[model samples]
Target: MKVVETVSGIRETLANMRTAPGKRLKVGFVPTMGYLHEGHQSLLSKAKAECDIVVLSIFVNPLQFGPNEDFDKYPRDSERDLRLAEQSGCDVVFMPSVQEMYPNPIRTSVSVKGVTERLCGASRPGHFDGVAAVVLKLFHIVQPDKAYFGLKDAQQVAVISQMVSDLNVPVDIVPCPILREADGLAMSSRNVYLSAEERREALVLSKALGMAERLAQEEGLTFEALRNKIEGEIRSTPLADIDYIEVLSYPELEPVDPSMETVSRTSDMIVALAVKFGKTRLIDNVILHRK
Candidate 1:
């Protein structure tokens, strides 16, 4: 229930806790924008279970969103987020303002070269750079023993992992499973933009992934064939416009060559898709182990 608005305030509070503590306090941190949802709650619940203290940060990072993107309209409810964080067992809520986090112009950013070149990165230029910079800043600010991120943003997870390893950030980056709605839509704060019809159309992303999974599992289909099928499914939905459909090697995320049978046999594949429903872009993916 305690909300610390300034960065200095958070630092002071944590310092006091560190000095008074008998044992070294293990803190788990979940950094997010201020919209509380079941997906975020899932992360907090896991953090609470594992760590002695849980810190949830609710700052709508302006740097992460492009000029045309929804930075201004991004849903924010600090009061609601605070209550939910408290209910989910978070000890401290860090709600720093834009000015507080970015006092002067930022010069440097963390960027993972290969992984940041495809999927979401391909479409949105400088998106991952912004994500990397803000996340690094948050890690420095919170200085938690462990930090948690949802797997819904698979590429983001990969990028962050790479940054942490390269930079030697002294925290464990724990990736939790993707939380989905009962209807199978991957939970997202941006899901609010979907209207009644667009909402129905949005399911195509997951459905296409399901089709790819079936093909990969049952038909013993090649990566190219499976990717084609996924793309076909998305195109079939009138409201859906395909952005990118790729089956890449897991973790490294390099595009797999299905023509080379040996590559398919040796590699674990991941099918990832990004499609635009009207103006809202949605992403979904499924991982398959080649037999």
Candidate 2:
């Protein structure tokens, strides 16, 4: 596996890789903030299975973090990440510095509407703007045929998909499933910050999601009731500080009123939530399929 830290180096390396004996190479890209784990591995494995070459970009984008957020405190393990990258079928690893990524002051950005009005966007103002901007920059830098993202950040997946569709970017956005820990907690880089007890308590997120999914399967369960039940489940844990619990129409994320109580079995939906355990915040969701 080749690890390139400079933007020019990655572009040059990928450019070289794009040239084969007789066929055009298919490239799959996975953009992440480093601290590789099972979730990231899953993305790389999927990319490898689908493409001729796989590139992994690791840069903890300051743009994605709020002013008060843990940009500085986010975990980093370059040596370990490199080992994991190669093991997970990543061909080239793009680990750029902040200065390398943003050499000049960034005056322009990309944004998606509607999807950004709630959840992480509402809680952390300008968060998705940072995500969209950085993602766009990376997409330009990497220029892969397809990019993979985990559904753990379903809203992010939605926002990026919207950006890609509206901008007509040539890359295909592949949304992968969320990988959870053995016990149930959703995997996240921020999860490392959780204390031993906080980590254990965090299981409520997956448990709540499970219950919500089963409850929502019922033909008459209202979105509001499902959301409230989720909130209550998480609240039952003393350490789980609630951020938001919402049930919305799938990729659209449109809010459905409680009065329209009987959810259509044919309508696809999602129940997503963000809760803080100690200083660490985690997000998890389940997509309800059309019955």
Candidate 3:
């Protein structure tokens, strides 16, 4: 696999590859912030299975992080990431630097409303704005027919999907299933931030979500009651600090009213969690589908 750094080089390379005689390449793209893991590999593997060529971009987008968030300290291993990408059948690796991507000061950005108003968006102001901007940039750069994302960031997937539909960007957004650790903690690049004890405590996020899903399935609990129960479970873990626990509709992420009582059997709901274990904050969600 070839590693391209400059914007012009990647564009030129892709253009050339497209022009190859008798070769029709259906390109699939996976945009990541590096620190490759099984979650990322799942995306690559899916892309490889469905596309003629797969491209993975690893640039720690400064736009996606808040001023107080861990941008500088975010874990990165380009050499290791490249190895993982190549091993995962990535045809090309676009490892651009911040300077290369921005070139000059960025005066513009992209965003989707309603969907960005709650959960992570409300918790971290302007977070989705950065995500939308960088994602659009990568979408433009890669120009893939299909781009993959993990369903772990359900809100993010929703926002990006809405943006593509609204803006008429000609790329398919494919959300792969969330990959989890054996202990049920949602896999994240930030997972590396947790200490051993904090890591063990982190399981509460998933455990609570699992319980919420089961309750929605069998117990027919009210939205408010389910959310409160999930929050109570997380709080039970002394090491877990709750950031937000929300029960919202799928894709739209519209708030499920507290007074709505029980959910219909056919309703789709996402139970999302954001909790801090020590200095590391992790997010996890479980989508309850009609049985």
* Alpha-carbon lDDT, every model: 0.84, 0.90, 0.90
Superposition error at 39 for model 1 (Å)? 1.0
In the range 114-143, model 2's lDDT, one tens digit per residue, is 999988889999999999999999999999
Error (Å) of candidate 1 at residue 275 is 1.3
Error of 3 at 101 (Å): 0.8
Candidate 3 clashes between residue pairs 3 or more apart in a chain or in different chains: none
Candidate 3 lDDT over 1-291, as tens digits, reads 999998899999899877768877899999999999999999999999999889999999998899999999999999899989989999999989999999999999787899999999999999999999999999999899999999999999999999999999999999999999998988999999989999988888888888877787655567888888898888899998889888888878998677665755456878888889999989999998865
Residue 4, model 1: lDDT of: 95
Q: Per-residue lDDT for 1-291 in model 1, tens only?
A: 578989889988877766644678888999998687898999999999999888999989888888999889887777778888889998999999899999998988767899999998998899999999999998888899999998778888889999999989999999887777888898888888888999998888877777777676664456667777777878888998888888888778887666554323566777888888877888877777767
What lDDT is reached at residue 38 by model 2? Answer: 98
Query: Any runs in candidate 1 off by more than 4 Å, and if so which?
Result: 261-265, 289-291
Indicate whether candidate 1 or candidate 3 has the larger lDDT. 3
Minimum summed lDDT over a 10-residue window in model 1 is located at 258-267
